[model samples]
Target chain A: MSRIPEETLRVADRLAAAMAREMRDDRVAGAALPLALLAALLARALYAPDLVVLGSLGLPLAPSAWWPGSGFRLSLARAEALALRHADGRFALEDAFASVFRGRFAIWISPAQVDATGSANLSAIGDWRRPKVALVGSRGLPDDAGHIPMRYYLPRHEPRHLPAAVDFRSAPGRTPEDGRRGRRRGGPEVLVTPLGVFRFRPEGVVADSLFEGVTPEEVTRRTGFPVTGLPEAGRTPPPTAEETAWIRRLDPFGIRALELLPPREARLAAAAIAEAEGEGM
Target chain B: MLASLTDVAARVREASKAGRLVAFGGSGLHRKPLRAAEAIAEAAVPDLRLLAPLGGPEVDLLVLAGLVRRVVFSYVGFEFLGVAPAFRRAREEGAIEVEEWSEFAILAGLRAGVLGLPFHPLPGPATGDLARTAPLAEVRSPYAPHEPVAVVPALAPAVAIVHVPFAREDGTAFVPGDPYADRLVGLAADELFVTCDELVGPGEVPGPALFLAAEVTGVVPAPGGSCFTASPPFADLDVRGAIDYLESVEARLARPSARAAPGRAGGGRGR
Candidate 1:
């Protein structure tokens, strides 16, 4: 291990501490937070996509839970030590679950409900004991949110999903107590939906940018909580010609577009794709 | 032991005759032993308790066949296609008992079973409705005492069916990348059966072999057994086939006659 100068080490520590404080205070909506986070990371000269751990890359497998040999063991202290070792500009892509347990990764997960506080609900819609609707139980969000940066991806940005307060806190966001205690190094980063990208601020969820043809009025009217649009918030940029070509090439079946479309349209598109693929076969 | 697919299916039927807990191995949409599951479904076995850490078509198929009495699972859904059709329908109809756990909790439970321990404690505090709904208990560590650990009970399956890319007649298998808790499933089951795409000769088994060969009760050569999901080296996921299977099942369920005719033999032909 290369020995770092004392002054450089102290400066890095101080910068990290400040960034953590700012991250704790920032409520995550979807669009601009990525840029903000990226800028902050770049300032620290630690912005390497390869070095940044990812929770999943479209694999069907849900991130693993606590298994000694399988998933990373569920020990924060041990995971912290592991994270410390990877504080250098290199991250090992050992296991998705391992990287998650180390709390040095970012995740884009869909939750049943999200609140202004950035808390996520993926467990149940009704009461805890006898739920009217039982969702997939909290997989790793309970252990993950406080430790790792989390960005939400919701197909629909409706009042039902963006509730005032989630029924259950599957993955906790910043709160008054959290702020006071300086807990949660990693929390909500952004919430991306079809209509717009949102960020969590101390006040509430703020609209960072509306998608093409989406209006601020539509976003505000749809959200369960009061959503304020940033003064400079504008239309989300359309994909560049090159980007569009790349996307078309990579996703010939338009599977990624399924996430942005309505359910009925998505189903139709899927059926069409299947038919096309069937014909090819 | 090396056995024919039909013979292995027969063994599964015999082992699960008592309405035993049968765990299906594989993560969502990846190398699921669906062929074995299909055989069991075709046999029209009933009253089996189903278990999976992360399930896809394997769990849904059994549920659709009306063979599952109870389901102990972390998550059981088609990845992007949305909620599993049969599992969702069964849950909505209150036809099967559901015990939900986190992926970690399931792993911990299986680990407990593998170690012959009564329970295994998950690190950190339990969160969300799972802490209330899941079959977990709280016990303080003797050393710490201050921190209470959420403990999941041992979940030993009566039979575990796992799919592998390659295996030998002696039951040794090559599992590339993540086993996805199949090893745990093998060790935690009373009888572990593996269905492989290629049943190679003893010396022909390739890759770094790491699995419960000793615990595996039987090995069946089942080429393309993990289809519709994935079995790397043979093929990637047959997405169209999977979607077609889902739609076909949904259509069948929509029919009035089929509504009353679940668990019927020969139901596996839809796939």
Candidate 2:
């Protein structure tokens, strides 16, 4: 075997170390990090609890999100990424995930969008073959930085039986596109980096003025690749009283990865936000 | 034989420059570092248009870095073995052209090419995602989707090479797995070169290798050389050698010209 350079060796070591975390509390949850992420993320995001995740190779989320029942909340001093649940039976793709988790929402963020660059699994969100991990926001959970579908209480699409509501703005990338001028689109808003903290947006990613200790190149390279655009320090939009009443319930962290839309693409972004009735993102 | 991977890259660069339509295929980037790296560097040529089954580091870098004009692949990530950074970057840039395929369908297409058929008819569940992407997969009742299309034109290569564990003076050889693709590629070639561990005789050709003797050319033995082509157990090129070669030809791969004289890539590796 070739003796690897110290730098490449270091990168490899860091990657190996970062891959050892989990988000759930059961043996199946911790052991089946891949299956859980695929199922939970899709369940929570698209409100499709039945979408079965087939094996997808190269999907990094597996080794990344090690456990279950985890959420990415910024207000906490510490964080936990997994919870416990019995292993559901095998999954079936022919079954429509779109209908199962009809009104759920699970927020997703790429490693490219986070400051914890190493924390991000580059192929996790990109791959569709394996049951990938769903622990996103290695940067942080989404907030109402901009778009708000007026947090509904119950699930949205399953309008008849279940209802949900949650504030999905400020949390991260602009949802529903055209809704926000490009400023709020394309990139993640909150960033928790190994180097420091920052935010990203369509205009460009910027180090919070307070953490000027890091360089943009350092941020970009450390994050595995170059980063652009970030959310601007602009006016904050408040939710209307009418919009607040609309959010009734939520059902997050119960579906699979295939069910959720591409977080950044307009054609595939999440269409509705269901309250986390009893689930986690 | 080339002294190192750099030498191989030089050949690839020359092939691209001569207007040869370059085609590349391999399983994924896993335990095999040398072959993987060489594949990445070769695929990163600037001017040569990258043709792939999907988008990933090599294909992406080829496009995003402006080395390749376009890429043809079904799914980049699905095709990745484990580590793939170059593909992710290329995809993010939208400097890509996407084509979709099922694992079976893609293999069938290659088989069709190897078999010298125009297109192979597919046979499988032709519903949902696979249907939307593989339009050619849709055919008449007997010519169902996913079966190899009717006639996959041959994929004759200007020069085809593969990395193997063994090779000998007379040219007979053996590869680890199902050698269908390599067989087709070799049959479709005017000159086929294989780079292997050492020049072995009948003693090494066991099991599967024992059977595939007539199909292969001799292994071009080179101590510091990397088998810069098709793979299995996997091997690498000389590192300093690779660095020296790629660093020197960085410019050639960035903005390739469309001047390839694509020879007829036609033939079949009769299994």
Candidate 3:
């Protein structure tokens, strides 16, 4: 395995310790401190009753095992993605869209860029006609973002990703345009990043909770746009002992490492771990 | 009568020659008629306009082979595997014409075709960059002019190709799991061609028939047709095969001179 930077290791340890401390102290909500912020947020969301999550989260492990329900409704998933779902049933793309269109499911989207207004850009990085980097074209984001209750998860919290305005608004967010358009059913409820969890308000995006060891000043420095509600923001709650145990049990191989580690390292580490786990099985 | 993969390719080539729109069934990578797609690529059909609700390697294979003229799709990428490198490169280079839509709107278009309607009106918030790029028009309700609805025109493909997990000789086919727009595509197209992984006898199908015998124009019996893609109950996605294809595509992209015929290399492993 490639050696990780000493600084990165120290930072991870510090953050993990802080989260552990908060979990023991507050006991407000349960989150997994050791798991990536994205998984932790998902663990917290799993606590919600009868919730249906749509969209491929791109985690290394299957999320269905982690869900408290009998089955998590996974849709728009390819074979590779559905492979991760374990026992959960798959929904056809059309059926999945129908549910989202009807405002039945809370959709989770990961976008290349998310503006201050909460609009997501999954289409391209530069110009539409000839983009410098053409990402996946707006699949269902354009059709469903305004109508459905949406949550965003960004693995990295940076200025480039959290821009003042997205180059292309693939999905309309909390902007007045969405409200004026009609039937806006609470678009972009929250955005979870490694640094913190942010909620969209009528005013704009604000920090609801910062991750352990992540400060308001760090968030401000990282974000390109102005984000308020940090001064009063509290630490993101850590998962309960039971939740952590569930997470660890389900993901015995640290599959969350794929989301946590850098790209190259992630692939290598995940492969080695998966191989080891496979042999053990 | 059961057809062969060669016959299926010939039919698709004929459709291409007639300047007809061809729709491939499956979203992203699951249950895609990849073997048929590979056969089509081998046939070297030119200037084909392909429509998929959501595509992945099947669409990318054609694009890589330089057989595609235009693509009408909402999304086209291997979900976890990564982006559709060929499709992305083609669109970025303006080598292929693209009509992008939200999944809901495109499916609505397919529905319009299925229902024999000129257009289909979908509810709420379709207006965005995708709507602007797509061929959708806003129409106000005659009684309620205040409420404007975005209507997608009929998407009647000349031919629809699907990979059936389990099928019988008389054309009764069973889709083991999520029927990802396969039935809709079959109904919308003028000609429906099905390729199956397993050709069963009478009362031998593992599940209820999702594709009726009457609707099928041709049935091609090709076992493991959806390899590298998923056709649950029969096979899981061959992850290693998928990764190999992706890596090959990336390798080809790096060396422009090595634009060989994609054939099987660009598609799933022939299990």
Summed over model 2, clashes come to 132
- Candidate 1, DockQ score (0 to 1): 0.17
Q: Put down candidate 2 lDDT per residue, A107-222, tens digits, no spaces.
A: 22222222211112222233423213211111111111222111111001121111121111212332344333322222333432223334444443444421224455454444
Chain A TM per candidate, in order of listing: 0.63, 0.24, 0.72
**Interface RMSD of the predictions, in order shown?**
9.3, 18.3, 5.5
Residue A191 of model 1: what lDDT?
80
Model 1 C-alpha lDDT per residue in residues B124-153, reported as the tens digit of each score: 556545665578889988997776767989
Cα lDDT for residue A139, model 2?
13
Off by more than 4 A, model 1? A1-47, A52-94, A123-140, A165-187, A201-203, A229-253, A271-281, B4-20, B210-212, B260-271
Per candidate, the number of residue pairs that clash is: 10, 132, 3
lDDT of 3 by residue, A51-145 (tens): 33322322223344345652332121132334344524444556665555656644446688998988888888888777777777788777767
lDDT of 3 by residue, B1-271 (tens): 6878788777777878888789998767677888888888888988889997878888988899888999988788876455788888888888888888887788889899999999999877465677668888889989989988878899999889898888888888887576767778899999888998888889685865778999888889877788677776665555556666776787887888766465463334455
Q: After superposition, how far is residue B97 of candidate 1 from its true place, in Å?
A: 1.0
lDDT score at residue B147, model 3, on the 0-100 scale: 89
Off by over 4 Å in 2: A1-281, B1-21, B30-46, B49-66, B74-83, B96-98, B130-137, B141-159, B177-181, B184-191, B202-207, B210-218, B222-271
Better of 1 and 2 by DockQ: 1
In Å, candidate 2's interface RMSD is 18.3
RMSD of 2: 18.1
